[model samples]
Target: PFFLYLPHTAVHLPLVPGKNFKGSSKGGAYGDWVQEIDWSMGELFKAIKAEGIDEHTLVLFTSDNGSAREKQGSNLPLRGRKGRTDEGGMRVPCIVRWPGRVPAGSSSRALTCTMDLLPTVAAISGGKVSKTPLIDGKNIWPILSGKSKDHPREAFFYYQMDQLQAIRSGDWKLFVAMDSKKRNWGNPEGKKALALYNLAKDIHEDNNLAAENPGIVKQLLAHAENAREDLGDVGRPGKGQRKAGWVKKASPRLLSR
Candidate 1:
């Protein structure tokens, strides 16, 4: 009956750890911070066991994005960093555990996003999400329950700001611009070059197959176009862009300092 959302503020900027853990880790400060995060999770699990509800709780652990380049975090065997549409930027680790309900130590390679959390939680609580406005998330409860072996998600669209940069369908990923190397967080410009890779074979995205797979490229392009129709891209403006309701701000009053 209780829902506790814990958002930890570790492994981020101003990365300082307690004195006891400062020089204990091999990777220096960031490693110490990571150690603290692990210890914190262990303590949380201990507390849950103490409450005698460990088997009844569903625990999901994940990060918002991939490792940051400046944080000494490694996203090895994957291309690009945080702020890019590459696998290393979009793909993140996800772990879910429910003692009796979910199978222990089972892993799925299915594509899932943080947006899916809203619908997943709603499905678990037997609540209905609003249909007046469209929701981009799909119910992944079936996958979590092991009732379904396949994921409902078929495609993933990558974007920087309002620009659509890449699309992944099946094991194939296509990037419209090959120039997302540097992290320009707010830049609206997308690279003009095109690139493609089969993630199953090239998780590092070292090989470009766009030239050999024209049919696949066309199919993934259609997926990107479909997304643009609903959520118009800044790089290529479309007619289907939804406008946000304007919020009026209060007028500023002049006061003597």
Candidate 2:
């Protein structure tokens, strides 16, 4: 009957662990913060159980991006770190829990993004999303509920800030040519014009198959163009892009004397 979105600031910058959890973890401060987060989730679930909403509540646990390179976090097996467009930066784990709705102890290799959350939640709640601006997300309830095996998304475009960095369709991921300045620590040298990788075989993105699969490269490039037209790239405003919210007057809050 109600929707709750809880965004945690823990396990992030500053790495300030609570006094109780300060020395509880062996991985130092980072591990201590992680332990605190685990405890926070446990408290949340305990409250849900107390309210008798555990059966109907759908909880989604995910991160916005990979671990920070400066911190004692690792995105091992995947190529890049937080700011880059590599799998490490773009890829994140999503865990969904809905008692009988979602399968238990099961995993999905399907390609999905945070953008899909909007439509998926809309579908679950029998709500409607605006079509005027045209949302990019797709309903992935079937996929999550294990009712469908097909990937609802045809392609997912990767963007670094305003720049269109890469595109992934199925197992093939193509990193478009970018300036060295735009490159992050993971992609220090910047990517070639069409550096491709088959994620199915090379999850680390070590092998560049662009030279061998020219046809696939061309296909993905077309998808990139479509994304650019719809979502926009640097310097190019997309037709579908809506105006961002702005405030004409702003003032900082001050305590009353």
Candidate 3:
């Protein structure tokens, strides 16, 4: 009946744990912050049970991106880090909890992204998404509820700023030709131009199969082209992109006096 978006500033830069949680973790400041978040979740569940809405609530826990390489976090087994287009930069944990609705201890490997949250939440709440301006999200409740095995998303495109970086369709992920800077991490040469990986088999993205599988590369390229037409890429503006509202001489104001 209600929606609560609780975003925590912890586990980010300037890690500051509560006085009670300070020095509680052996991993130092980062671990202390993690423990603090764990405590926060416990408090939230306790409140939910007290309100008797625990059974009706559908909770989703996820992160915007993988751990920052500069931080004490690790994205082991996956190549590259937060700023790159590698699996490490794009992949993050997504946990859904709904009592009696979503089966406990059940998991799905269905590829999903942050964009899918809009439609999925809308579907779960019995809300309708507007037709105009378009939406790139898909309802994934069926996938989450274990009612469907099919992938709701056909493909997911990756972008670093306005540049289309990669495309993932099914198990295949293709990185098209593009120049990169040194900060992209793994790709020290600063040019990946063309690369392909079967994520199911090569989660580390070490083996490049782009030469062996030309057909797949071509298919993913076509998908990328289509995305560029709709969502845009470097040097090109997408037709589907909505013009952002701007204010002339905008001024900041305090939320409270």
Candidate 4:
């Protein structure tokens, strides 16, 4: 009730629905799964109202990352799928409902990320941070209050621990793939490369504008330099922030190579 994270683990793997909600939707397996998640959320919402704290409570609903829409998961109009720099993977679903606090059925496309949550909650609770650094976020109070409609930070970096690096500046997003001589970003294509998408125009990311727009690439790279520093070489081992279990003792050919 105090801190509720209603994440859908079933959405990630196996795609299995429990017996209680096995075939409950007109949309098939995925639809049924979505309905399950929705039903659970309804419970949370009802509980808050039952406690008569709906007005004071702030409910933030969002996915961790974009859906791997390419995995037959359904990206639809959004280009690309999960696990890539496509909008589907990064452009998550989010909604904030606060009775009397937030305007009803409103939307804000101010470009946000997960890291911004801590500082916001801290500010909301009047928290004190003596030693712990703010780390990749700040208190986005203005946005929540409907006073501001843009990100407070000058720049935001999305790091996939070396597989790729994405930096957001204003409306432009730059994605640079990390190639490890050990395993490279696009080696499945063997010399394949990272592609850039002007999410504004090519939300589906169908066109590879990297070669056609060298000037844009240059500009994006310059902006991306800041994010790349913290990004490790994906093809190279031991560089990722948190090593995956499979990467621990894997051979170069199996790990990065």
Candidate 5:
């Protein structure tokens, strides 16, 4: 576990460097900060090579969450920023390098996520999952091994501040922002609704397809029920009605029908 996750403040704080990496990245205050993180990887990898533990190890690297625009950091092309229910906040980058066990110089669009990390680790280490609550994770060993080209997860979900309940099923994603896009205030709309997108064609989620494809919408909705419980973000449970109030009581209008 070449795992390195520390609260790189300044992006979240007042003024404080670790006194180690004074100047690193190309950016500036924030650039030095982010680059220190990247540079730490270089250092850790160097240590691994020196110890000769790298070949037998699987080094996985990823950001804790998203970057802060308040600090001049950029997610670029991804809408919204950190601490929001938007893609920019939730979307993250990950890289796993295992010399012999994992294929080199290839990429797999496995639709994997942080939620699946536990099961993946369990699978790799031959360990047991604690059966803990809100474990909506599955082992992505096959996908990572380049065996299956298709993603094991039928849907990818987003729960912002435990308020918004969103799901990306196949190419289409449905966002249920509890807070109104209208920004009318009032403890944020504890409502039920959805925003759809075909991620295959529109990874940016610039379009909505809920009205166009009701069948997929329904399937994902049902999936949302289980996912919510398994994910259980913000101390919110999965039972009862959806938190979003926009699309309440509306069944999907399948294109097949």
Candidate 6:
């Protein structure tokens, strides 16, 4: 009968932990912050158990974006950090717990994003998803309910501001736009260059297989073009882009009182 959305700000910038947890982690302030978040999650789970509806409740936890590189945090083995269109900047951690429905101690490598939440929640709550307009989410209930192992999402497009930076199709991620921060971020040569990586094999994204795999590059580029045409990215204007639902403000008319 209730839905709770709890957004935590613990692991972000200004990594300051409580006095009790100051010296708890080997990762310094960031480590301490991470531990504190774990503690908070434990408390949340305890409260769910206390409510007596733990069995019926479904909980999902995930980050909005990848870890921040501006702060001294580690999105280790992930090529780029926050603000760039790389796995480290977009690929984040997600955990879902639905007792009796979702299998326990199970994990899937399905490609999913935050956008999928809207449709997934609608499917779970028996809501009309067709009424929702201008949505990119797909219901992942099958993947969650143990009915299917494959996800319906074909590709995920990465955008920083209005720019379409990258797209990941299957296990390969291709970069159409360059990372502007590549110079200071450590790879000057890769700045604004076309890059590609097989994420399954190169988790760190050290290898740029774009030159070697022209066919795969072309395929992913097609996917990107389709997304651009639908979403209207920086250089390309989309014909299929949905109109924004902005309400016009009406001017007040002067009346004799």
Name the runs in model 1 displaced over 4 angstroms. Answer: 177-183, 186-191, 235-257
TM-score of model 1 relative to the true fold? 0.88
Error of 2 at 59 (Å): 0.9
Quantify all predictions' global Cα lDDT against the true fold: 0.82, 0.87, 0.86, 0.67, 0.68, 0.81
Clashing pairs counted in every model: 0, 0, 1, 7, 8, 0
User: Between candidates 1 and 3, which one is better according to TM-score?
Assistant: 3
The regions of model 5 sitting more than 4 angstroms off are 1-24, 132-134, 177-193, 227-257
For each candidate, give its TM-score against the true structure: 0.88, 0.92, 0.93, 0.77, 0.75, 0.85
Q: Model 3 Cα displacement at 42 (Å)?
A: 0.6
Question: Which scores better on TM-score, 4 or 6?
Answer: 6
Give the lowest summed-lDDT range of ten residues in model 6.
181-190
Cα RMSD, each candidate: 3.9, 2.5, 2.4, 6.9, 11.9, 5.7
Candidate 3 C-alpha lDDT tens digits along 15-34? 88889988998878888898
* The candidate that achieves the highest TM-score relative to the unseen native structure: 3
Error of 5 at 135 (Å): 2.7
Lowest lDDT 10-residue stretch of candidate 5: 177-186
Error of 4 at 253 (Å): 34
Relative to the true structure, candidate 5 has a C-alpha RMSD (angstroms) of 11.9
- Model 2 lDDT tens row, 164-208: 889999999998876642654444564456699999999999999
User: Can you rank all candidates by lDDT, best first?
Assistant: 2, 3, 1, 6, 5, 4
Candidate that beats the other on lDDT, 1 or 5, i.e. the better one:
1
Q: On residues 24-97, what C-alpha lDDT tens digit does candidate 1 reach at each position?
A: 78887888988888888999899999999999888899998777885658888788788777788889998898
